[model samples]
Target: MGIGSWFGFGDKSARASEPQPEPAHTVPTSQDLLDAVDRVEQQAKDGKAPGMVQSRLGRVARTVRDTVPRLDTLGSGSPQAYNVMATATNYLPDAIGGYLRLPRQWADSRPVDRGKTPLMILIDQLDLLGATMDKVFDAVCRADAEALVVHGRFLEEKFGAAAGGGDLIIGSTPVPPMPATDPSGPSPLTPPPGRTA
Candidate 1:
């Protein structure tokens, strides 16, 4: 006010020189993915989609729910990760919303795509999403399964045979071998010197 407002010279220059705040780069969380799934499910329910559509939608949602916690296994910025996010946040919702926008009777009866009606098309889309989600879930699980296999192999290599000639080996410790017994010797189960059974 003292210098810039009076002269009108410093105000514009100072404002231009100041750094602007960057837009927030929002990273979706697992809960966000679950909430998206919930929204899509509720939409399908409220929209009164056919039984088949509801079933397929449930399949995709279930798989996405299972996979959300393991998305890190798919790696950040990877295609699988992106697909999971996109399916939850956009593709699934868009497909349902598009169908829902149409009047129910026309959507169910009219064949907009060749011989298939909108209902059929929506079912197909849901099936595709379901399969894709299944694959993504499998990929996430497979990462942990592979790690387990690798660890088993490592243990086998490091510890040699776990049971070699009936001798057990646990980690680095070797189980003590059974004492040798003479065929003619007194029964090993006999009571010791001072006691009799």
Candidate 2:
């Protein structure tokens, strides 16, 4: 055997045969995403994030909550779905956590990048996440809305009438029309001889 082999470094086949490590980043489950969001909220509250920061965090959290249920609609392979997962599990928590790690007075008051404080940077990140989540939510909901429209069109075509404008039918019976009103009579709405209403 070669010197390298003696040192356990020369056999490519052996290296290939060894078990590999799991991926560093696996897709999170829905519950995992929600737990992350809850952690972020608790951190924000405990860390005393500013009102502005809290507001932004709340927006991102709400959007994440709204989007999680519709992840399937976004398709497991879609980037939008990935964004939802990452925003909850990584982007949002990281942004808030990083800011919380800093001295509050300094993080809020001192500029760290291009004249922006850590607070400002966190806000920007939160805003971006919020907007992305909003878009994903809209995209998911749009699919259902479009289906409703398409179904309505199909229904209209099958019934041969506008949705609410034609004679009503239930199973095999047509609903009767209301009797005509007499033009010369006192209005039906006028109480018999106005006793106090």
Candidate 3:
């Protein structure tokens, strides 16, 4: 007897499977985050008790004062900026890889080989930007003739211990050459003039 017959199976297609329902919880939107930022900025501006009591509050207030105007002018709605923001948010690995290429491209485009120029690794989102930014920063520091200019918050958060007074200012270090790989299966070797292998 077949296994199905032994199990007392009668109808081949009697019952129908029900489709699973998606979860009802809504994820926080970008506008929600922006609204939160606005609230924080307002609190800072109004000197609200608990939030305004911190020692660094004044510094944060000043930064907000400086950044708001620029942020308004830049307007997160621009296509180019939105594209970059989306790339950084959704596909950080590709973003970092592409970002690293900028300095190399700039260096290559220069007329003379003046060694590596100073590199400014601007990490916009401290919380959202992944650890790969750190790796890229390290790579830039290790490359020959490259100086790093990192954002203050990222420097403090990531390399705080190594960050002496404030900010991480890494000098250039020599990068070891990468071993070359043969593109084709095997390198073609020309036989010696008279002898054949």
lDDT, candidate 3, 80-175, per-residue tens:
334323333343333233334455455334443234221223232222232333333333334322223344555667865453233343576555
- Candidate 2 regions exceeding 4 Å error are 1-19, 23-26, 156-162, 169-197
Top candidate, metric TM-score: 2
Ranking by TM-score: 2, 1, 3
The lowest-lDDT stretch of 10 consecutive residues in candidate 3 is 118-127
lDDT of 1 by residue, 1-197 (tens): 45765665666767777698999979789999899999989999998988899999999999998889898888889788889999999999999999999999999999998899999999989999889988888888999899899998898899885564576779989888888898888798988789988
Candidate 2 TM-score over all chains jointly? 0.73
What are the root-mean-square deviations of the candidates from the true structure over C-alphas?
A: 10.1, 5.4, 28.5
Q: Cα miss at 158, model 3 (Å)?
A: 34
Q: What's the C-alpha lDDT at position 45 in model 2?
A: 98
Give me the overall lDDT of model 2. 0.87
> In candidate 3, residue 187 scores what lDDT?
46
Q: Between the candidate structures 1 and 2, which one is better when assessed by lDDT?
A: 1
* Candidate 1, backbone clash total: 0
Q: Candidate 3 regions off by >4 Å?
A: 1-23, 44-47, 50-197
User: How high is the CA lDDT of each candidate model?
Assistant: 0.89, 0.87, 0.38
Clashing pairs in 1: none
